[model samples]
Target: MPSFHHGAVEIAYLDEGEGEPIILIHGFASSKNVNWVYPGWMAELTKNGRRAIALDLRGHGDSGKLYDPAEYGIGTMAGDITALMDHLNIRRADMMGYSLGARITGWLAYRQPERLRSAIFGGLGIGLIKGGGPGENVATALDAPSLDDVTDPVGRTFRAFADQTRSDRKPLAACLRGSRELMTEQQAAAIRVPALIAVGSKDEIAGSADQLGKVIPGSQVLHIPNRDHMRAVGDKVYKTGVLEFLLRRP
Candidate 1:
């Protein structure tokens, strides 16, 4: 549970295993532990001889919290990832991210491709380019005083997740308000790193992984059957795809 500074924000992270580096970024309302460690990402990557480095994005986990809408976005969080890499003395490493993490990875792929060997995007799909980002629904849900007030299925789920994780509601609300930016089709096409788009076939939140892959050069899609957005995070198939992709690329 070590932490570092990215400007005024203190980003907490966990570094485990030993080998070539792989940086892991958690999704919205998730920390390194919930997103990667508790799900066994560290063990799998490390056992396969890769370093697993995970971070608590600024507004989540034990990292610094900011309620300002201006404080969070694609570039802001993506900058946090690279800053963490630089702090660890890692110029480049494989990058894996889920949900919002995947979006930040998208920005990384476009803004700092040299800082990544390959990018693994889980729980992201056709929505990566076409449309739909974290909109006001989820944000408003986080601010709702009680679950009884949230009616949208997706918003209710996110609010429940925030409650379950004991995440700060205010920061999360602000994060949702400010940080739903998605990469354009042209931006996705601009990624220079080898990429893998893995999505659950049943995921309502992310859409089609195969469709997203069609736009990114040298990208592949790994579809996990019967899993939805939350279920897909710790799926064995998703892990296997990531490990194999790393092996092939490494």
Candidate 2:
């Protein structure tokens, strides 16, 4: 339940265990508890003598919410992570990010590679353009409700999304908006630290494992067979691949 003021927004996060620090960044629409803690990742990391820190990105979970589109940019979110590390006096740490969080972690790795010991990215990929980057697309999406008040195809899709948003729509929407500026293949190639790329075998959003493996240099991509985005992170295959990759000395 501990919180830190990262710039103008307050970020809520869980800080537990003690050893080499590992920061866990959850996907869009999910909190630390729902995404990482519920899966027992905290205990798993702690059992291995590694500190686990799961952060509820700004505008998600118990963190402060900002409706301003500019405030939700990817740069701002990445800055929040840097600020958190600074506040904790952590000079360097391993990082793991999923979905929107993954995109942000990529940016952090590109911008501040020196501060990272290693990184794990899941549920997202480079060159995947969906919602428009930054303000325009996000502002538009945030204005639209999950339900469109019609029974058409679009409405049905909205209804399904609404069900997922029931837990926390505002932050989820903000994360979607923020990720519009994710890096491209050229940018991702600039990363020098050890990296891990993983996705569920059935994750259409992240594309095929072969594609992810091709882009990152010396990076290992693990495909959790028969699993999709949500299931991949919790699966034994996914956790084992991630833990092993993180603990390996480069």
Candidate 3:
């Protein structure tokens, strides 16, 4: 339940164990507990003698929520994390993120590669392209009714997301609308640290395992069979794969 002020926002985080720190960044809409703790990742990391810290990103969980769309941009979000690290006096640490969190980690790696020991990205790929135009308003995108209005397969996925949003509407909607920008190839190639890219075998957004593996250089890709986006992180294969990758490094 401890919290830190990162500029105007308050980021809620959990710090456990007492060794080289590993920051776990949760996905859009989901809190730290849902992404890492509920999956037993914190216990697993602590049991292995590594310090694990999971943060509730701004506008999610116990963190402050800003209704302004500009406040939710990836750059702004990444800055929040760097500020959190500064507040803690941490020079560097291993970092892991999923979905929107993964995008933020990518921005951090690009901006301050020296501060990271290693990185793990889940449920993301190297398609760093801009979605909406620069002047387009994020609120407009979010205000549009559920994607069920469209006929494409991707639209169906968005509709499913919208269904999830109804249960916990604010945070997930903010995340979905906020993550309009994509990661550039230049940024992906710049990540020289030991990287791990993992995705569920059935993750529609990231595509097949081999396709994702080819984009990230020096990345070890693990496929969580019979699992899709929602179930991947909790799957035994995903957990074991991530731990093995993290422990393999110095």
Candidate 4:
């Protein structure tokens, strides 16, 4: 793993394969390895002649961690991505993100369209505009002394995931607290780059993919059958649809 400084934060990342680049951003409580590499996404993209890049967002994985909620704003997190691109001398690249990563990608797609050849919002949909995903309860869960102390189902699930990942819960808690901002309908409509909205058909967390697709002009939607939020990440259907979208996008 190589790393570079983005302001005061050290962002750790993996760069693999060749050809045009596509950067992968993982969801909450997950790193590049757990979200992309262990799931074979890196192999799939690299084998298809694409440059696969994935980073550990600040406060997660091997990257620098911050306890201040103010430091983890969605826009600030998105800036980290842009800084990573600049460091690599990449002006633009295809971008894909899941869950929290999807929200960060949405922020970039809306505010920094010139830096993205295309955008993929995985595990996110109309919630991009509706403004609801993990909330304060999830943050509380991270703050809990143990998973047993987390009574909220969503919070408990995230706490268990954090435990499983061996993540430091304090920074994650601040991240959850600060990164919950949402894009408006106008912002979603303003995205002009090639875009794909991929969500699990059974994903309650992502809202409706079709609805989100309706908002983003010319965007394509792919629904992974019978998959929920977590299960959808590594689905073959998702990989196939994403590859097809990347192949055909302008």
Per-candidate Cα lDDT values, in order, are 0.88, 0.74, 0.72, 0.94
Query: Could you tell me the C-alpha RMSD of candidate 1 in Å?
Result: 1.0
Question: Could you give candidate 2's per-residue lDDT for residues 30-62 as a string of tens digits?
Answer: 778877898888988998889999898887778
| Predicted structure 2, TM vs. truth | 0.87
Order the candidate numbers by TM-score, best to worst. 4, 1, 2, 3
lDDT of 4 by residue, 67-151 (tens): 9999999999999999999999999999999999999998999999999999999999999999666889999999988888889
Clashing pairs in 1: none
**RMSD, each candidate, Å?**
1.0, 3.2, 3.8, 0.7
Tell me model 1's lDDT, rounded to 2 decimals: 0.88
Among all windows of ten consecutive residues in candidate 3, which has the lowest summed lDDT?
130-139
Which predicted model would earn the best TM-score? Answer: 4
TM-scores, all candidates, are: 0.97, 0.87, 0.84, 0.99
**Which of 1 and 4 is the better model by lDDT?**
4
Better of 1 and 3 by lDDT: 1
lDDT of 3 by residue, 85-159 (tens): 887788899898887777788777777887788878787654333222211232333344754454455444544
Candidate 2 collision pairs:
none
* N/CA/C clash count, model 3: 2
Q: In model 2, how large is the Cα lDDT of residue 106? A: 84
Give me the candidate number with maximum lDDT.
4
